[model samples]
Target: MSGDARGLWVTFEGGDGSGKTTQAELLRAWCEDEGHRVVRTREPGGTDVGQTIRELVLHHRGDIGPRAEALLFAADRSHHVAALVAPALARGEVVIQDRYLDSSVAYQGAARSLGAEEVRELSLWATGGALPDVTVLLDLDPVAARARLDADDKPFDRLEAEKSDFHARVRDAYLALADADPERFLVLDATASAEDLAARIRERVAPLL
Candidate 1:
């Protein structure tokens, strides 16, 4: 995706409570320290339209059908890339995003049994095949991840409140994605120290910068 673009796009992916937000913030700060302009954002809530979709897809009280959920996420992704990510890259600003197509592939696709390749293709079409220069996958055990969330004492969102098996499927799907595209993915152990993970992420991203 960065082949013709002047800027780099880096996306973070993982299950809920995998410390994706924390690592994304660390990378954002490091990029600023290195004198790079950074555009930090997240999927489903990256824009006004996305924020509404995020609420519907993630926090709504009732159930959303699998295909409907996938389409909602795709809608958010389409607008997010067009209105935010693409513009930032055009201006030569590093875009650090939390989650992306990978989340949709893992959650709505694998966990929801909607088929990974199908979900991926939908996202690709939605974003006009836009992809990140680098993707960081923070792999973590679902049990451990759940423990982290429980410790936080926050109410679980719709996806986060799913059964353990569902989350396990999401993790497996993520690992498969990393394995399939090792070049674009930096798979890190979410169990590692935050500082250690940050350093490893920087090492992977420095060359791209």
Candidate 2:
């Protein structure tokens, strides 16, 4: 690990059932094995306050206005960065996160028909412009992702329950984000074997450590 005062921040982004959690855990274990302190967390529920917001946004029975949903996610990001992420990095601990502003931009901005730039700006403002050192994007077809979700036999969350078209738009938005920031993004095929994906992610993150 580098003896630098600041630590690395790594985030994973993808649609439902894209295997982001699996990759994140693999990276976490790898970092720990390298003798680096690691902090594994996720947006919308990384902190105690964020847990309440996560439930309301992800599991609420009724509909939530698109703008309201964006705001709620931003609020969670604000608190999560302040109370958890930033502090972890300051302590020189690697932060492995499940999602970040990219999800808000993809889900609430482009997919919901709101302006992508607008939602991105709101998230940047909320987090005081925090960004991950590396972002691994598991690109997968919406239909395939849906099939995987269905196989789990678990109830879908509000976002996961969205129509196919919605998920397609989210996928496009994520790709666009990656295109705009190629340096920070490692876009990989979600259909690849878990070990292969983990190896690629490790390759990208090893230089930072």
Candidate 3:
């Protein structure tokens, strides 16, 4: 948002099975159809370097200390913001990213017992205080989220495999973030139908466009 480009940065935040990707894709397609260039990306794997970092942090077999894991995510975030996210916006494209600093704040800071404020500060420092124009939080119960994941038949990543309590804490942290910044966040219930959710997201994004 702070970047000096005539573009918009929209990010999605939620639990593992919260349908963030689906909604983001929907928005991207709608934007493209409206003649707006759109880039759909995700944290931890938004770039080639980020993909490697994602494997180490989310798919590695061995146990990684909590601090090390947090630092790894921060590292990937730093590179992603500089390499992919910033340039996309600079080109006047609509960047609908799946996650941003909020994920690190929720997963590492709140769920992992690292302070959210500190984690946020770490990311801000890394990115020179870059922030999204708008962030959409798809709210859902972690239990429901887990059930949706179970239905996918795909392997759970490291964080997705965590206990329900961990995810619950993550959700709480996400809601708290939205509550703290109502003007910057558009909170939506993930329980709604995908089409319905997509419509609501479009409604919120229309103004920015």
- For every candidate, C-alpha RMSD to the true structure in Å: 0.6, 2.1, 1.0
Per-residue CA lDDT of model 2 for 21-49, tens digit only, reads 99999999999999999999998899999
What 10-residue stretch in candidate 3 is worst by lDDT? Answer: 1-10
Give the deviation of candidate 1 from the true structure as CA RMSD: 0.6
The worst-scoring run of ten residues by lDDT in candidate 1 lies at: 1-10
Candidates 1 and 3: which is better by TM-score? 1
- Cα lDDT tens digits, model 1, 1-209, are 55879999999999999999999999999999999999999998999999999999989999799999999999999999999999999999999999999999999899999999999999999999999999999999999999999999999999999999999999999999999998899999999999999999999999888
lDDT: which candidate is best?
A: 1
Candidate 1 vs candidate 2, TM-score winner: 1
Better of 2 and 3 by lDDT: 2
Q: What TM-score should be assigned to candidate 2?
A: 0.97
What is the model-wide C-alpha lDDT for candidate 3? 0.92
Model 2 gets an lDDT of 0.94
Model 3 per-residue lDDT tens digits across residues 1-209: 45476789999999999999899989999999999999888888999999999999989999999889989988998999999888888898899998999999999999999999999999999888889989999999998999999999999989999999999999999999999999889999999999999999899888878
